[model samples]
Target chain A: MSADRLIEAYLNELATAAEALPAERLTELIADMTTHIAEARADGATSEDDVRAVLQRLGDPRDIVEAATDGLVQVDVPPRFRLRDFGAVALLLIGPFALVIGWLAGVWLLWTSDRWTRGEKLLATLGWPIGYGVAVVCDWTSIPLGLTLAIAAAITVAPLIPLLKNGQPGRSATRTRLAGATPATSSNR
Target chain B: MVAEKVFTQLRRGTLEYCVLALLQGEERYGFDLVKELGEIDGMVTTEGTIYPLLARLRREGLVETSWRESESGPPRRYYRSTASGGQALADFTADWERFRTSVDAILRRGNEGRRK
Candidate 1:
């Protein structure tokens, strides 16, 4: 094959290998390689042998892309489940019995803590207070107090269903996907 | 296999500093820098990989690059050490010296023990 064709094929392979890179970074990377090849040709590397040697020295496209993406492969460290979070969940469930101030403290904990996501916090906040209010209203009406309490208890505990999965908070699926896609020991020896 | 792994790890640690060290004397285009690094025995396995490393150094503000007109070809991207890069190199130099001395002492003791 001609020297130009050889360079084209190398660059095509590089693009394919670098598919995971962000669009801007991939463009910059390709431009750098193109210029490198052009400079080599200008330096009298006109022969196919010389061009091949240049590409060889540049090494495998996969290795180059791996190097490009090395920093991006970092594993996201999730915040550890702490005693404060446990306390937050506890207050969320039982704090209202302490004087309603306890539940307010629990709401403060729920919002301030990072253990639960925004959606989870919202559910916990709305479900516990509103559900407890519904139960109080039922007590004031003709409905039996025992049945109303049971319904309130179920509603209050429902929010914990997602939080208690495997006894840990939910991890971001995007983080898990990224970590799985780029294993740290992926170097081709 | 073990020695090869050691060389790979060592290269990863020192290769960027070597690039920064080269740029300390003068600004050089990408091709020239890659060529020089490739010439050093066991220094670089793949010259193409240096582009990514260069991109990272630039991103971190350790190096600055500019496009310069080339007489024989397209404009070239020339790299030079930034103030931060120079400081990092100096810090690495001190740490490397201490690390090398410690490794040399341990290796020498190991050799002496084996000889006995």
Candidate 2:
């Protein structure tokens, strides 16, 4: 093959291999490779053999893509079920039955934490309190207070769904590493 | 195979610091920097990987980049180590000194046992 074709083929392979990379990152990688080739040419690599050598120095496209992907992996502090997180969830779940003071404490814990998002805090905070309030005011249930509270508790903790979806108690370290690295993959646009 | 894997790990661990060390007193464009790093034995097996590494270092606030017109061809993205990068390099250098000493001592002892 001609020198230019060889360079083109290598770059095409690189782009194909790195297809999983964010668009911006892929563009930058291609640009960098192209510039390196041009610079190598200017430095005296004119023959097809020299051009092939330059490409060889760039390594296999698949390996380059793999290295690039590895670099994109974000390292974040794993979300452990800390004592505070436990206390927040507990107080939010069962605290409402404790004359509302336990629930209020849970609300305090929930808001102060960085674990759950604002929407979660809003849902967890408002759901049980309002539902429990209505339960108290209606006084319509002959189902007995204990049973009603259990049902109410189940219904109110619906906000925990999002957390349950992601916050696996025994999540593998590799999976959690991928979890916190979302920003790199997400902010492509 | 195991030796190659260990070397790969070692290269990955120290490659960023090596880049940082190069950018200590001067800035270099991507091509210039990658070529320089490629000259080192086993420091950079894949030259293209340096671009991704540089991009990551930039994202991590360890290096800063800016574009400047090149006399030969297209505008080039030049990189220099940030203050944070310099500090990290200093910390790594100290740790590496101790680490190298310990590893060398262990290897030497192992070699002696084999010869005996």
DockQ of each: 0.31, 0.22
lDDT for A26 in candidate 1 is 90
Every candidate's chain B TM-score: 0.96, 0.95
Across A1-189, the per-residue lDDT of candidate 2 in tens digits comes to: 599999999999998887667677788888888998998898899999999999998889888777667545535545565687778788887786676899889889877776666777788788786667756754686778777767666668777666545443332222222222432321111
Model 2 over residues B32-91: C-alpha lDDT tens digits? 998899888778888878888888788778899999998888888899999988988888
Could you tell me the TM-score of chain A in candidate 1?
Answer: 0.47
Task: Please report, in order, the local distance difference test score of every candidate based on alpha carbons.
Answer: 0.82, 0.79
Candidate 1 Cα errors over 4 Å, as ranges? A74-189
User: lDDT at B2 for candidate 2?
Assistant: 59
**What DockQ class does candidate 2 belong to?**
incorrect
Candidate 2 regions exceeding 4 Å error are A71-189
Q: Could you give the CAPRI-style class of model 1? A: acceptable
TM-score of 1: 0.63
